[model samples]
Target: MKKYNNLAEGPDGFVYTARLPLSSATLNWLSCLIRGHLKKIGSWWRALSAGRIAGIVLAVLRCDQRPSDLAGGNGVHRTTVSRWVREVVGLLAARAPRLDRALKKIARSGGGVVLLDGSLIRTPRRTGTETRKNYSGKHKCHGLLVIALTDDKGRLVWVSAVRPGRTSEITACRHYKLTAHLRAAGLGAIADLGFVGLDDGGPDADPAVIKCSAVPAQRKARRDYENRVSTLGAPA
Candidate 1:
């Protein structure tokens, strides 16, 4: 078989190179899942192969390529690519483990505190007051907020529901009652200062959620000390 990089088309235009930032095993797994989904939906066949449809979705997601660009390369309509992406995304989303279940699994495995993080998924800033709720003043951008937790090995175990961009990490956690969930699961978390006050009752009240309350100011002070040391050409 021709290598991925050497799949460019010639006069026949029957072959072309496409780059997907995922391994072959991942691609094959996704193709298998899509094929299974098609079987369940009573679709015996499609114009495009399951592998190709999987490739289109992976390109749009992992590679962050536009659907139109993928469509042109794959000889399909842009809407087809978009549809494939949505279908595959929904399929995979249905398989994601719930936060409580994921945390319980980690706890049973004798794992320690997990890492917590949050980020915004950027969206186009259209000129409309209706979209004001999506504007995040902290990041000075428009997007959706999402929170995630990873195991000790840095594998994602849980993800929070999508919230407005204006939402803070701590606020989202509280909204979801993440503290009660973590305490119930017997798991702890180490998060950045963004979640400083996540545990309203304080760390002692719920030691499951550890924060830097003892030396909160030390984070900034350490950074300032490092900058001064570098400027003075001395080690402090």
Candidate 2:
């Protein structure tokens, strides 16, 4: 991959931002497109100033700021920010480019590679949500199964969240199709062992091929590495 030792400057004499794989102009264009969509969705823009909502969403995405945390950022109430976040998540999930295209752009390749993995978000204990043990068997938590597809650089292209602890990785993945951008870029999906199930007479199952795990040595390090590799092998 070609590496840029320093950030590039734009035609408008503004310094380019670091960490974003896309160029400044491209990012601006994409943000504008997103804002345009938000405007059309029942005047979320009218409910709150466009700048405030945009700022709140960007803050949440960048700093993990919750709606309650925005009480001091601007005069906007926490409830307003929370509503914006929900609307933003829903819009982005439906309108964002497919994972494959975003990956190909970042990698600067004709093809794209995506790492599909799940994350857990803790849910309120009082609610009737499912709870599960930590993989390490340390504690219990309730949360959704989130599968994210990211490029080699770990930039997220797509994310899908499901009910707290309702299903395993393979089942959750079945709800999402390969992103359109990824499909256009001839992208490939990679996942862990929990996903290695046989096809269920579906067309989406054909591209994936599972490789079985080998017996592991008694040593903990070797056993862990083997387990990781086995999980990374494609699902059947």
Candidate 3:
């Protein structure tokens, strides 16, 4: 197999073109954040440029490229790429605001309500008793249940901790004390039927979260709803 740069790489691999999928500004921001974090810990040097490091993490995160491929491209061990990914992800997670804090911010900004929804976050299946615990009868797969709150414009504001996928979304909200928090913040939530009973529409319940219109109880409708929710969290 012969290799060429332009029309073809050869019988072994074909040449292809792609866009970065993220803006230059986003890449630069990630690089700066990583650099600042390293500096704060008194680390001085890295084999790859901060921008390049950001690119590697983004490729794996955004493009779903494999770590082994990324390692080969950068001439580093696969473990090194994994480590960088862990580091970057941890840093970003730490910076995300807590649910209460985000709610307060939205309230202060004069926002009336937030959109709340639950998703079945996909997870790899493991053998044993754990499988039954993580398995969702609705989706018929193993995953975690996660509640997410988004602004009216669909921007993510907060996400709940992972729970067993078998847990009902309405039950998950109660566990999180979401209604109390929303009331305290003087905010409401608009949720899908999964959270139909999240708020009782009582007169005393100020700024009550409203549930969307109910879907039919037919088995096909139920399955369709579950399928749509599962797809929202499935990896590309």
Candidate 4:
């Protein structure tokens, strides 16, 4: 009987969602991942005694606020908050190699999906690059090339971000290389149009791999009609 297990109304007009058993399971998994990182860095003892650095970092990832706001929320200084973020980046870099093998094992077990997509993150105003603009369609805004992979139901699994808006989506895809990992692990992948044609005759492309298409069709009207029909029949 968890105290917060039942749904309630929030101060805002929206519903307060109940935390599912799966949410707890996922949090436990995330805790394990953080603990593993602390152990690898030989800071497990420090992490346990020095306060909830990993928890704050996770909160930053989950929340809509800035890092400073996250720090305040966790009752730590902004610099300490930034350090926690840095540690997360370091841990991810170290763990990325391990992920390949783990993904392969998961794929072998069968029936998973990897969704790849990108979104624009505006440049920090303090960064000098913010001044350099590109004018193609609208006023050229400096943006990040963000790629993320998720399960079919949209649970985030992996993420990568790069600066320089000119960085090709295909290059970003190849660099992250989740497709091969998913295939090896027994997972399917769904990617948008930017990732289409990547498998076409490049030295890096693998023609044999199977990936689910999240890519938009060239015939937009027909695709929209089909999409409406699919949405209507989708299980509630």
lDDT of 2 by residue, 151-194 (tens): 54676767765534545666566655443333445445555555
Best by lDDT: 3
Candidate 2 deviant stretches above 4 angstroms: 1-48, 98-109, 129-139, 151-155, 175-188, 198-207, 210-236
TM-score for each prediction?
0.81, 0.53, 0.79, 0.53
Candidate that scores best on TM-score: 1
- Cα lDDT for residue 55, candidate 1: 80
Residue 234 lDDT in candidate 4:
16
User: Better model by lDDT, 1 or 4?
Assistant: 1
lDDT of each: 0.79, 0.54, 0.81, 0.54
Query: What would the per-residue lDDT of candidate 1 be over residues 95-196, giving only the tens digit for each residue?
Result: 989889998888778775677888899998867785788899999999999999997578988988789998888889998888888777867776665687
What local lDDT score does residue 144 receive in model 2, on the 0 to 100 scale? 56
User: How many angstroms is residue 159 displaced in model 3 relative to the true structure, after the best TM-score fit?
Assistant: 1.5
Candidate closer to the true structure by TM-score (higher is better), 1 or 4: 1
Candidate 3 displacement at residue 30 in angstroms: 1.1
How would the candidate models be sorted by lDDT, starting from the highest? 3, 1, 2, 4
**Residue by residue across 30-119, what tens digits does model 3's lDDT show?**
999999999999888887888999999999899888898777767777998999999999998898898889999988776867888889
Model 1 whole-model lDDT (C-alpha atoms): 0.79
Error of 1 at 227 (Å): 25
Clashing pairs in 4: 104-185, 107-185, 107-186, 108-185
